[model samples]
Target: MSPRVRGEEQPGFFEVLGTWLPRQPWFRAPRGRLSLTRVGGLRLPTPAGDSDSRVFLELHIFEVAHQDGPVRISVPVALRSRPSAIAGKSAFIGKLTSPEHGELWVYDGAGDRAFLAAWIEMSRREQGSRNGRSRGRAHAGFAFGSPWTLELRRTGADAPKEGVTRSIVRREHADSQGEHDRDEIVMDLLRRPAGEQDELLESLITLSEANCEVIPKVLGTIDGAWKQKDDADDAGYWVSGILGVIREAGISGPDGTSIMRRALQAGDDLSDSARAAGRAVGTFHADLAGSFGAHPQTQEQLRIMTANVQSTLTQQWEQVRSEFDDDEAADLNEVIDLMRMQLRDADEPLMLQQIHGDLGAEHLHRTAGDAWVIREPEGLMSHALGLRDVVTVLISAADAVMSVAAETPEILRAAAEQEAAEAEQEGQSDAPAEPVNFGQWYEEFTQAFLSGYRESDADSAGVDSVFFRAAMLTEALDLFRRWRGQWVFRPSMLLQVDN
Candidate 1:
């Protein structure tokens, strides 16, 4: 057996990290030199009282500086006695000799099975603190808040996503004898360090505490911080937390975008689905307002919204025009001019609220159990005009419907030609094709979605039609740029300016 290394006798950990940090996907600095500083980290409980057990789990925070600026990242470090004991080949960090522990194998904690289980346990217990010798100091650190209040019933193994984050599933069994069970826990870890508390996620957690249906239940939050700038030693950087994964009865169903695309492809009626999505969004907004409270739509807020819309629209027009022919560009310019004029007329004040700033078909999910869940608060506008969410959803849906419809005819024409060619080869008749009534479906979906939104508890009476139309134009322009980049849009999307 080897003598254990005292805190002061430990090897230069950052020396080895300098070589390994660049290999991670979350390492954002351009391929060049990096200067590192140990900020802070937390310790996870390891097996106790086993002389042969030499495994340790530690999260290390480092401030990496490059030409641009300094970026903070959290690296979960796993120390093991042997290379063979490392969980995976990809998890390997570097091998180093410790004065007291002898030789040790280092691995990224995210990939280690023991680390994942330990993290779940720590989060469940709300245990947090700093550990290990950093910056010539030897002391154990503790988390900022009280013990975690939420409990996950069960946790399933999960793999890290990309190199940035990882997820663990919590399952709940069915009460009925023959009914199936489903996952309820969704633990998320941000590989890099966060500057402060995430207000949006915090709001969701609060709503979950209140038993809100739209937002996912926040089981618990785990964060690691280190003293950085202040003279007083304080926990600073936020690391990770656990959330209840929003799913329809354990089934993470397809998003609204995929569902709408399916209906458009099959020429099926999309009214019911679109209405349900709109209602879900409305319910989500209502819950947010009820939990966070709404703000009055001040004149300044209206101006900011309008100005932002104009600025985005103007920028997007440049990109959109580059992709169109001269005639199409001229037509688009005229539409842009009209939209700018409409923006000038948006003078009325309306109610504002915290909103899902990135609401779209893709950001929402519908389950087979007839439930809708807001997947994530990807973009949050704490004081946005409440109508912005409604307008954004409408514009996104309209753009999608129009873009798909416009392309379908050409696609059908090409398919028919291919079928004819095949038929000629076999000397047989071509198969009859089913016609898609895109306009009819579009109208139905548009009306139903808007109706559903208007019917929900979210305040909508003050939504000025002129403001709505202007926002729709701005959103349409951005969508045009996106569709053009993807080589999907015709002039039809631009025609939306007339509305």
Candidate 2:
């Protein structure tokens, strides 16, 4: 075994990481030099059979402490004896000579196909055991479940005996994990430790399995460094979640946002898909409420949620308020005022329940089976008014319309500016016209979605005009934050609300 002591000449791992980490987009660039510590981490083994036995894949997480606060960064490294063997040039970190392993060439582990395959195998088998050894004092445990890896592997082996060929062909894609079939497993290594919030995914997965088909089957989750922090020594890499990869079941389709954009551009009817998506969302929300149950919103809880939303809006608006003109700013103020008023008084106590927190056409996939499957739930994912989901989706729809509308004017303005410059010589000029009839499909899309919700027999008690107006206004504030300086698009459809 390698020396269990961390500082014992481990080829200056921390020094190499400090040099390579800031270049990564996900790792926030510190204001000053970063102070890194190898708190703890876990590893996924290479597949059972491989051509090269020397290659090793490990995810080393660090607690990057800056003046602001301590943030975690997980680095997946591919350790090889031959540095030249790693193909990707950008994946190369610095080479080092470990006392135990010797002359190790390290590259970003995410680039390795073997690393990806190992994670997929773990998820497929649902192997949640702490069988692997931790390099340091950290005691990391791997927990698997949902479909269970054994079940997935058995599905492959038992196919012939069942007189059927598993139609889901293996078509691998690149990301954290590598190869995947039409339907496979994906493993996401969370940068931070698993907290109470992490439980939301597993809860939703279990509840949705019984109530609806909206979510992909959760394969399993692996909790790293599962122990109470006795002191600074107890800190370690905390948690990682893995799940079954939802495959495209639809005959052919684009992402939810792209479809909306196409429908707007072509003036194509999106009523059917819109309605279906809305229904899917409504059913999912209903299932969440039914399976997990909800509580009546206390006055204190309402106040806290309202304050949090208000504070966020204030912060984002401060950054972008200069972009709006007098009239536009006033209009935005009215919206904020409306939101404040709505939150101040409620006709009845709102029903609080768990929801998919993040909702939009983009986060949804139309499967080959023509059913809508949701992916990527953001925020607490635990309990809140179901209307929060409704509000977020509505905002996303609005943002999509804004993005399409914003594109045309930008194109025309550039053309007009070019023409005006040439016309200056000829003493003739024409300004580009502003886009009219903005958000043309807004009403249709909103109605279709709501109609689906109503059709799903979801309780309407929590939904009211006042609540909806407040939701819209709040979402508008969220969007307004992006309108600063040069009107850069803040793809709301792609943004996950962080609570």
Candidate 3:
């Protein structure tokens, strides 16, 4: 066994993580040096009958102090005797030289198969044990369903023999017809543990219980407790929730590639797919509402939401106004004024319900049976306008189409010439016109999505067009502000069709 150093004696592990954590995509540290202190953690034993004794699995929670504030980060690490080629260099955290273990290879356990296998085994073993009970305290235990790995490995014939009649059975039967059928599972590690108040696990349970087939099934979850620095109790006092696991039935691919990009690349019409996605989202929303219940927004709530939107509009305009020229500025100002007017006119009471806070085309995936399944529904809002989710989807679809259009040779050349001309003229004119087909494509997608949404939940379909338009404009301006002076495209181009 590798020597486990405690407190100030563990310089190698802490130093390596301090340098590596900031470079990660999920690490949300501010733009400066960070002071990382190990707050709390748990170590899990390897799976039964495993011969690799040198490999150790641990979930460590660190209190990362930056300029802003302290952020708790949960890092699941797999310490191995040698470098892991399968986990690849991307998952490699850094080499740790331990006195007893010599050179140990440290990797992010979220990507390591061994770590995953061990985690699943632990959860399964602890399912009915004393650690599995929910005590309404910090030390609530494991909650899980049937093991997804075993289910995935089962053949259709075997399932029927066992009288199993699930959607997964149908999915497996379809997979048996193809030679490329492989078992893949996707796990989400909460970088910032939210303790028992974590909405993701609750949302997953709600959706799963309601038979919401549009999402991945909840396989298992490990809820652990850790001690914070400010805890007044003992050292090992359980204080936080740790990890969640879900079974991913869809085929995996590159993260940046969305369904829209795939459709465009294959030159396939996405109207049908868009409609299906819309229906899936609608069903998801309906299920969420049925589980959590929806309420009509109060006048005060409406007033506050409108004020926030207007404030965002003003702030974004102030930040990006310098990027636009005289003509472009006037056009943008017109859009902002229209948005304000629409906000004022949008006084109709809307239903406030649990919503998928960050819905986009990228989060939508197709399973082996070509059914749409939504992934990464982590950002669940307890009470928000369902239109917010719809608007986000619409904007994402438009952005996808715009991205494809921008890549075409004609549009690229036009953009280049326009940029050169604008430089020469000192940003005096408007942006170049969009491609002729761009508006049509965006319109087709929008209509198909709304149609699907309406078909699923007619009551939620009474969306105020003026409010939707205002929300779209607000989202576009927010995107522009986030782009941070990248003048490749203007927000005006996005709203030209609507205008």
Candidate 4:
């Protein structure tokens, strides 16, 4: 058995790395050991109810992803005791047979309750459907139905214990656990390898000194590490009641929708709402640059992650190539090669600035027209071109809105069959017809999403990054095909042959 890095002398945090990590869409590593460290945090528990650990237990597991690379994710885990029998695919992270009723798996009790309630109320309050928001009322609740990983698990009406302090601020811990050092380590973990901490601190200080209100104000770091020049906001890391703000935003009305609404059957109302949302994103990014400085990466810095990107693409591609076919594979390879060249040429100022690695209609707190700002709590994740985030978000939204007329795997077979049939038609060999442009579906789907992203002149070229990222995606799909014993074009065929 592999030796455990932790959980011996200290309280057990769970092996989640093995059983849980791979299943997460956000987890990058195929498998890597997770080391718990103190980033920065707070403990907010209401003094009401049983204090029995079940009815009232909210531990905000503020975690920072420390896997190799620049991707830093904020994982806020809420654990609450609940009635038993909620077992299924998740199996509740783990189970326990309490002396009370029966077996109970540690589950998300504060799931979306506070967060969603706040969000819903805020949305409704801002727009009462008169503006065509509210998912038309019928679909409003439906939109919130599926569990989004980004959202906490508290879904039902389960209320927080009364008298619980609304929220308390936390401070950065002196202990080096991932918890305490999250903010500091995030920059170290994900920022430019050669980037100095002093520079980041200076930029942050500049923002703090500016006292920017339109931008997200740093509430002081968990530690005094990010202290402002004015020394005005630092309260030694205490939690504040984000609840009222969250709730007000929720019922505020239809703030935004996916830009690819047409494909998803979203009407003008939602699309308009989404555009309004996009404006917020634009403002947020602008504010970030203003606060953090328009500083771009030096050429010397590019070399650092270039190798990492290449390696990640190569490795992940081998695993998922079955997800695409011969023509698709060839096309993806060609696009990636072209894109790399373009990126190398355009590897100029804008590509390197601090930007959100992931953005979506879901990520926004509220509409720009209303009151919304970047969730800096997510921290800055190291990423490729600025275009990467817009493309990814559009693709993801498209995936959400898409009806999935053809099964993804079936599309692969159709791609291969089409190639064989086309060759036969040209007097090479005879085979059945393949689905007409099996990948056209995904292409069209992603393009519809691109509509919103491309609307901004600054973001159109990012479509190219999607093509390169798709190369890694294609390779991984191919690997999946190999595993399934279903097959397609050889990797060589996808590569250009030397004359």
In order, the Cα lDDT scores of the candidates are: 0.61, 0.56, 0.62, 0.36
Off by over 4 Å in 4: 1-274, 340-351, 365-385, 402-499
Candidate whose lDDT is highest: 3
RMSD of each: 8.4, 11.9, 11.4, 17.7
Q: Per-residue lDDT for 1-499 in model 3, tens only?
A: 4455332234488778878887776677567666777766667655543344677777777777767667777888888778877677877988877565577778887766566665665654553224542111111122333332312221111111121111212123334533232234444556676566756666776676666777765545666555665544645545756454434445242222377776554345678877887887888888888878998889998788778878877786777788666887887788778778877777777788888888887777765545577765546887787888888878777677666754666655766586668766885566554444555566777788888888786246335555666667667766655644332234334533221
Q: Per-residue error at 369 for model 2, in Å?
A: 5.4
The count of residue-pair clashes in candidate 3 stands at 1
TM-score per candidate, chains pooled: 0.67, 0.59, 0.60, 0.37
Better of 2 and 3 by TM-score: 3
Error of 2 at 255 (Å): 4.8
In angstroms, give how far residue 65 of model 3 lies from its true place: 8.1
Worst 10 residues of 4 by lDDT: 185-194
Clashes of 1: 7
**Candidate 2 residue lDDT tens string, 122-221:** 5445444464423211001113212222122111211211111112222233232222232343334444443354465556456535645666544334
**Model 2 score (lDDT):** 0.56
Give the per-residue lDDT of model 1 (tens digit) for 353-447.
Answer: 88888777776777655556776654478877666777767666766776776677676677667767888899987574565665556557867
